[model samples]
Target: MLPAQICARNERAKAHSSRYNSKRMKVGTGRLRPHRSISAGHNRDDKRMKIGNKSGAVAFAVMFAILREFVMKFVSILLALPLTMAISACATTSTDASAPAAASMAGAKLMAGDGSARGTASVTEAADGLHVLVKAQGLTPGIHAVHVHMTGTCTTPDFASAGGHWNPTGRKHGMNNPAGMHMGDMPNMTVGPDGSGAIEYVIAGGTISGEATPLLDADGAAVVIHAQADDNMSDPAGNAGGRIACGVLAAG
Candidate 1:
C-alpha cells in the first residue's frame, strides 16, 4: 500500500523500537537487577560476619592470656607458702637447741671460807656428763662433809650466814634415805695432813643449763666444806657444823 522506499524505512524503525523495548523488559524483570542487589548484600553480610568472628577470636585470646596469668600467679603463691613455713620451722628449732648450750657457758666461779682458804673449781664436759673439778689448798686433815649451800655471799665472821643447805625440791634430808636430801649434799671429802683435797664428782641432778634444771639462779649459790664428818644418815643437813670453805655456783 506504500512506496517501496518508505515501507522499508517504517519496517526498520519498528524493528529498532521492538528490540529496545524487549531489552528494557528483560533488564527490569528477568533476574539481573535482583541478582546483582542480592549478590552485593551477601558480600556485605559476609564481610560483617568475618569482622565479628575476628573480634570474637581477639576476645577469646585476651581471656586466655588473663587466665594463664592468674593460674601462674596462684601456683607461685601456693608453692611459696610451704617453703616459707619450712624455713620458719627450721629457724625456731635451731634457736631452741642453741639456747641451752649458751646458758651452760655462762659465767661461773668458786671461793673459800672468808675467802681465806681459796680454791679454784672448773667445769668441763665429759663423755659421761658434766664434771666439776675442785682443788683446794689449806684445810683441815680429816673426813669432812662437803655440800653445796644456798647464797653467794662470802663476807662474814661465820660463813654459816650463807644460809642453810641448798634444798630446792623441798624434800627431806639423807641421799641414802628414800626422801631426797638437799641438792648440795655430797659424799665425804677426806683431806690429808697437808690440808689439801681434790674432789671430782659428776653433777647428779641435771645440767648447768636451765633447760634441764636450774643449778644456780641469777643471784647465784654456794658450795661449802663442813667442819665435822657427815654420818651420811642425818636429815636436812649432816651433823657437820661450821662452813670452812665456800664457792659461788653460777650458771656455768
Candidate 2:
C-alpha cells in the first residue's frame, strides 16, 4: 500500500512540472513575436526616411538651378545698358567735330576809293543756316549796293572794274529769287553819316567745299560797294551804278 501511494504522488508531480514548462515556453514565444514585429516596423520607418531625404535633395537641386538661371539673365541686361548709351554719345561727338568753323577777312584795300576802306567779314554755322557778319568803314553815308563779285583782280589806280558779280550759275540780279539772281546779290546796305555800315543775316544754302561753287573760292572773290542803291529787281546788277570800293577776299 505504501509503495502504490508513492508511485501515484510521483505521477501527479511530473504532470504539474510538464504543464508549468509548457506555460513558460508559451509566454517567451509571445514576447519574441512582439520584438520581431517592432524590428520589422523600424526597418520600414528607416526606408521611408531615406526616400524622403532623397526627394528633398532633388527638390533643392532643382530650385538652385532655377535661381542660377534667373540671376544670370538679370546680370546680362545690366551689362548691356551702359554700352549702348556710350556708343550713342560717341557718335554725336564725332558729328560735331566734323563741322566747319567760322572764317574772317581783315586789312583789305579798296580798288576805287582814294582812301582805303577798312572792313571785316565773318561766317559762323547755325542750326538753320550760316550767320554772316560784314562791317565796312570810311564810306559815304546813303544807300550803297554791296555784292560778292567774281575775280580777285584789284590792280590799277582807277579801279574801274573788278570783273563781274560772282555768277557761278550764270544767273542775274535779285535776292530770295532762285532763278536769275547773282550769287553775290544781297540786300542793299544803308550807311550812316559816320561812314560805317554793318550787315548781318543768315544764308540758307551755302557751303565751303571745292566740289560746290562756294562764295569764297580758291581764286578768291571781292565784296564791292556800288555808288548807287540797288533797284532790287534789275537783271544784271540792279542798276546799282559803278563800283565805288572793292575789298579782296582771301583765306587766312
Candidate 3:
C-alpha cells in the first residue's frame, strides 16, 4: 500500500474505536443508575420540600383542632360547675311548712310616740290582696283599733302626721255602717295584761304597689293603733281616739 492511504485508514479506525468506547461507557452507566440533570435534581428537591410542608400543615391543623375541642369542653365544664353546686345546695336545704312562702313581701318596725320600741309588722302579697301581720308591745291592756293609715310619717307625740285612715274607697269607716266600710277598716286588736299583742288580717283587693291606689304609693302607707275601740258603726275612723303606735311600711 502507499504511505498516505495507510495513514488515512489508520485514522479512520482510531475514530471508530473512540466512538465505540463512548457508546459502551454510556450504556454501562445507564445500567448501573439513570443519569440526572441539574434541573431534574432541583425538581426532586422541590417535590420533597412540598411534601414536607403539606405534612407539617396537616399535623398543625389536627393539633389546633384538638386544642379547640379541649378548650370548648373545659369551658363547658367550668360553666356547669356553679349551676351544679347551686342545685345541690338547694336540694340539701331544709324546708318548713310553717315558714313563709317565697312571695313578694314588706316589713316595718313600729315605734311609739315616745320613740320606744313597739314591735314589728309584715305584709305579704297574695292573690286576693295583702296579708297583714302585726306584733305589738308596750301598750295598755285593752281593746284598740288597728287600721291602715294614709302617710308613712310618724312625727312623734300624737303621731297625727300619719294622716287619716287609708280610706282608698272613700266609704264610711266602720264595718257595720249603712254606708259600709273603708279599705283601712280592720277588726279591733285586744292587748293583753302583759302589754303585748299579735293580729293577722287581710285587706281584700288591695295592693302593695303598682296600682292607682296601692298601699305603698308615692306617699307610702302606715299601720296605726288607736287608743280606743272601733264601735263597728262610726264614720271616718270609728271614733278611734289617738294614734298610740305608728309604723312606716317598707318594701322587702
Top model number, TM-score: 3
Worst lDDT window (10 residues) for model 3? 94-103
Candidate 1, residue 46: lDDT: 100
After superposing candidate 1, which stretches have Cα over 4 Å from the reference?
1-101, 105-114, 124-130
What TM-score would each prediction reach against the true structure?
0.54, 0.56, 0.59
Per-model CA lDDT versus the true structure: 0.70, 0.72, 0.87
lDDT of 1 by residue, 1-252 (tens): 569989999999999999999999988786667888989999999999999999999999999999999999999999999999999999999998887444453223444545564566655444454566667668779887877666766555567656777676776666676776766667777888998777877756645545444556655566777788886667868688777777666554
lDDT of 1 at 245: 74
In TM-score terms, candidate 2 sits at 0.56
Q: Which stretches of candidate 2 lie over 4 Å from their true place?
A: 1-39, 55-117, 124-131, 151-163, 175-179, 202-204, 210-213, 216-222, 233-235, 239-252
**What lDDT score is found at residue 202 in candidate 2?**
64
Q: Looking at model 3, how many pairs of residues clash? A: 0
- lDDT (0-100) at residue 190 of candidate 1? 81
> Residue 250, candidate 1: how far off, in angstroms?
3.0
Model 2 lowest lDDT segment of ten = 100-109
Ranking the candidates on lDDT from highest down gives 3, 2, 1
